[model samples]
Target: DAGVTQSPTHLIKTRGQHVTLRCSPISGHKSVSWYQQVLGQGPQFIFQYYEKEERGRGNFPDRFSARQFPNYSSELNVNALLLGDSALYLCASSFSERPPYFGPGTRLTVL
Candidate 1:
């Protein structure tokens, strides 16, 4: 099966702008996904969604939001972007509560 894939591998935006990152999980290994990552630190749990429902969220601000599609793909949307938002946004897929399979991250840079 194909591995998780993310779109717009690299992105650049300005402060106060909004951005969206997309991810497609591996086939047949759906039902759950979590997203988070930085350049230097370990992965941070941003959000978890299963069956198109949001199951968990991390300490991120309201400007950050995400949703899973019926196809099990997901999108992370960030509004009012800040330089602090510049980082590698990762997506992972898993079954039930199992550990996730991470995707190549989408790098976002806020100018």
Candidate 2:
């Protein structure tokens, strides 16, 4: 009964590079979502996947994308990374649209 898990706890990349983040949901969960948290600010929703389909997305640009697996795991990808992309990427999972349990997050640093 894990909450949520994200890999590569931290990452470093240069501007214009691409990075991928991974997430595994809790047992019995069917929905997974991604969020970005800049230092000193609240997390901003990025994407929501339910049953391996996208259910919602935030105001992020096309550089941000994500997909969920049949097993309820998910991956978040960012293209053309910018210094502004440095943030904590969080993964959340739940049974429905309600509040979801979040993972520790992957810290992305764009140099």
Pairs with backbone N, CA or C atoms under 3 Å apart (clashes), candidate 2: none
For this target, which candidate reaches the highest lDDT against the unseen true structure?
2
Best by TM-score: 2
The TM-score, computed over Cα atoms with residue i paired to residue i, of candidate 1 is 0.94
lDDT of 1 by residue, 8-41 (tens): 8999999999999999988876655555666788
User: What lDDT does model 2 reach?
Assistant: 0.96
Residue-pair clashes, model 1: 0
Report the CA-based lDDT of candidate 1 relative to the real structure: 0.86
Cα displacement (angstroms), candidate 2, residue 40, comes to: 0.3
Candidate 2 per-residue lDDT, tens place, 18-84, comes to: 9999999999899999999999999999999999999999999999999998898999999999999
Model 2 earns a TM-score of: 0.97
The lDDT of each candidate is: 0.86, 0.96
Q: In model 1, where do residues sit more than 4 Å from their true spots?
A: none
The Cα RMSD of model 2 versus the native structure comes to 0.7
TM-score of each predicted structure versus truth: 0.94, 0.97
